[model samples]
Target: MAELYELSMLLGDLEEQLVTCMRCGMCQAVCPLYAETGRETDVARGKIVLLEHLSRELLKEPEAVKQRLENCLLCGSCAAACPSGVKVLDLFLKARAIINGYLGLPPAKKAVFRQIMTRPALFNRLISIASRFQGVFTRPAGEILGASCARFESALLQDRHFMPLARIPWHAKMPETDEPAGPDKTKVAFYPGCLVDKVFPDVAKSSFKALRHHGVKIYMPANQACCGIPALSSGDRKAFMQMVRCNLELFADKDFQYLLTPCATCTATIKEIWPMMGQYFPPEEQEKITALAAKTMDITQFIADKYVLQRKYDDSVDKGGVKVTYHDPCHLKKSLNVHVQPRTLIRVNPAYTFVEMDEADRCCGMGGSFGLQHYDLSKKVGNRKRQNIYQSGAEVVSTACPACMLQLIDLLSQSHAGIRVKHAVQIYAQGLG
Candidate 1:
């Protein structure tokens, strides 16, 4: 059929990259899903085999191969540990697009991605409406964690503890700004990703405070679109491109030194994924995306590198203080190699004593939509992370990604553990006061 021919053509782009995988099984040692399920098909090597079969037309049912591919967390663990430097995540994303194009996305996903997610104004309107009425269906479940649970039995919500949407999201509170850089200071264009904008507005506020204290000027546009990872990870390339263009157009004329985001996932998507997928766009658009990607920085990285030495931390502080531990989101650590900067930010905050958790860089298993599509598997991986946090003996757990914070809250709340979750920027911002 013509559809299969097109699918093969799309998959052919990755053929040269795919052959580089030597099937060394090094990925199994780092894969979170493979450790939990222990299935060959769940590991990167097995999925690579399936992709090769489909690309060569050796597999009859591409849908089965698609299903096997969707089982991954997209955490980039295998790619980070790959001996041959296979670029496994890149191959998996493109392969998903190829196979999903062949099989067609489900009606529900099609509607959400195309109709709602790609449109910023419509998405904000719907989320605002949901925030106003969420209390009627959800009740505060974890007072210390500040999370909520379903008021009644609901299959969609799954009795999971979640952060309620802020009645006034960050965009609604501080709509737009074009603050010029102060003398000898860096100017940044801030992209507070969806979770920070809606559910954790305080993180956005703290980032603003920290940036302001360092005399960094900001250009924050209102009605910014999603970073497209949710769509791209779901294999909806059309929706992903739409979101990317929306953001690129909004940020086109702004002359900022850096494009910073408080969310690790968003920073990684813009810096790494955008440029990697730029070949799909027009040359001009590709140029803009590449330029923007070059300037993208995680908030912690920006502050730690530029501002840490400039400021003074009270070095004479007592050891007996509020103990804190940090969780490295996979996108920040494995994807972008940003493990040290967040720790550096924490170290510069003298009010809190930093403690290292066991396996600090392990994936917390909140691969964006991975938690929603595969909740049981997600929870299993999260519980292992929770045990590590518990063993760390810290009262507060800090992480760079809002998604990781959500997963940590769920695991701690379900187990009735007393550990609280905060963004690294939030902790660093407090010490700035």
Candidate 2:
């Protein structure tokens, strides 16, 4: 045995941050997984207890600790509701890194995230090939959600109603852009994260159209890497750092006042995780990373703050016209304290009556890898969200995170549920006549 790597060095830094958790148990009230499982380990309080144990060396089993850590949605609900202000995100992210560091990456994910994801060109090429071959191997399971099931019992496909990769990724289609920021306007560098670039290219296009409609100067550089959420969440700090370094170099000295991203997960990771992990870097690099983090903002928040919407409110409902519900992504709402802005942006479109779903801010159980690692639990949690969406009786369920859209589609599609998953901006952009 090479001997499992020790986590003490990193755990030392997290001690003070973990202490702030206070074991308040308030997180239970809001955590979606906890709501479903009723397990302390599934909630923030339980996760905190595990961390305290891990830090104190009460638990020697890194795998056990890692499993508990992975049980979370990383939705930031507990952090949002925490009174003592525990940096749950910092703790969980670092904890995940600690455990992943010990066990090493799984062979399959290592092949994909490490060999493939780290290299954008190869990653894009591989997914493109998979997209073309998908039809031969997969069959439609649900037409309502445009979801497909495994054509055969392939070990890779599992039970996923995966959103097939688009024929042309955004980067392939839009290699780069430089269409003048027009007049004296602060140019924004928009970073549409991987899913938006690949799986939901139209969402990225709509975001681009909406930005242009607002007359904001935009500069989207090509070859942008993953924002490192997947790597970081896996505890492969090396891969995460690779992604960060790649992104930093990509947007080097663009003279843009803001870094805007349509993806909620990307926005939160840039705003919160970038500055956080920067502490380990040398002073000069740290300063630059800190500055970059400061400039990043969610597109919805940026639009709400920077542009004034010319509202077209029709107070009358024309026979149940357009019922849409907004689901708050944890990163956008909890991590960023930005729940109302997207809703406000939604309301700008008077044609649709925006009805808030029950536990609108609840985790949709996507949690990036949480869905992959614990698919059974993911669906168990997602089923609740599906019921909530059905309960809301809204024609559309809009959220900022594309990952959530994927999960919602899987759940809604399988149940033969009549609901549509969408981005709030997509709804708003549709109203931009």
Candidate 3:
């Protein structure tokens, strides 16, 4: 009971943001989960009201509130569409931390987030071992997508087609680099996010290829930690802070004009979430985070801004190329306002014809761990995206986020759609050839 009181007080700190929700139901129009579930509790307005009641100590069941909050995709659709401009993501994230801090995280997550994920070396070593033995338990599900399914029925693997861990992760291939910036060229610190590093190292390689083609210098540090979104979203604030501090120590005082990443989630987490959570750290540590966040940029954003948008391309160079469509990542589009830059990167690729998919900015339904927990709902939301992609009649589908790529690969592969999934930077990199 005392703990509940503490939780309520902690949640009370977010009351100002909670009151901003006008209950206009505008969030319903954009929320992918609500669209499928058709439940008020699935939308941001209902969640905000629940948080409000809990903060006031009027709600007795903190568990129920936490469940309702976890049901959300945290795609930022609600916050993006809110007329009152409420910070929905911020409110939910903080509320989650408060409640979970009181109730305690689940055993499995507590172990993974606190034990394995927080330690970069151990995390890498374990994943590397898993990669070697994955074939014993999983079988190839799709050739084009390079996805695998469990050989036998497994609760965790389920019926989803997942990208197998890379045989040689990006870090293993090229642990670190400190290439100098050429005359009149920009120098960037490259961060290959977990998925890109382990599952899709080619994306990292392609991004590096694109950077080199554009005369950009590179600096990548070893022993880099996860961006901490996984921990933060799971309500493990301690683990999240540990990861942030780890990354801060790595990139601090490094000479780079911008921090670059191929994964949209990494870019958004660094540029937005890191700063939002910086308040928990000391003043000096906060300054380092703020400076690093300012320097972060999505690889697509950097290339498009520095090169593609500035140079006029000859449209007639390649008329009959692969028909490619773009799926905008929620973080890149809503969180960072980076929709234009990724599309610009695609349009400049002469080897691919840029075709627009219906609702190109619709959420892909991955939502990080949200997909793992509520995969039935995740697949339903993702099916809508699949229909749009199929209807586009494009031979290839591309996105800036590796997480979205994983979701797209699973959805498209389940239906036997032969469409290839590539990062925008990968497509742009092909043009360099």
RMSD per candidate (Å) reads 2.3, 2.6, 2.2
Among these predictions, the greatest lDDT belongs to: 3
Model 1 stretches with alpha carbons more than 4 Å out: 1-6, 55-59, 310-318
Q: Kindly give the stretch of ten consecutive residues in candidate 3 with the minimal lDDT sum.
A: 309-318
TM per candidate comes to 0.95, 0.93, 0.96
Off by over 4 Å in 3: 1-9, 55-59, 310-318
Error of 3 at 233 (Å): 0.5
Task: Give lDDT: candidate 3, residue 367.
Answer: 97
Question: Counting only residues 3 or more apart in sequence or on different chains, how many pairs clash (N, Cα, C under 3 Å) in candidate 2?
Answer: 1
In each prediction, how many residue pairs overlap at the backbone (N, C-alpha, C within less than 3 A)? Answer: 0, 1, 0
Question: Between prediction 1 and prediction 3, which has the larger lDDT?
Answer: 3
Badly placed stretches (over 4 Å) of model 2 are 1-7, 55-59, 154-156, 310-320
Candidate 2 lDDT over 1-433, as tens digits, reads 3223345667787777777776768889988888888888888888877777774443467677777888888888888888888888898898888777777888887777778788877877888898888799888887667788888897656888878778888888777886566686768898999999989988888788788898877888877889999989988887888788888887756778889888899998988898899866778777778888899988888887778554544534444558888888888888888877788777777677877688887788998988887888889888878888988878888888898899988887777767878887787788797
lDDT of 1 at 236: 88
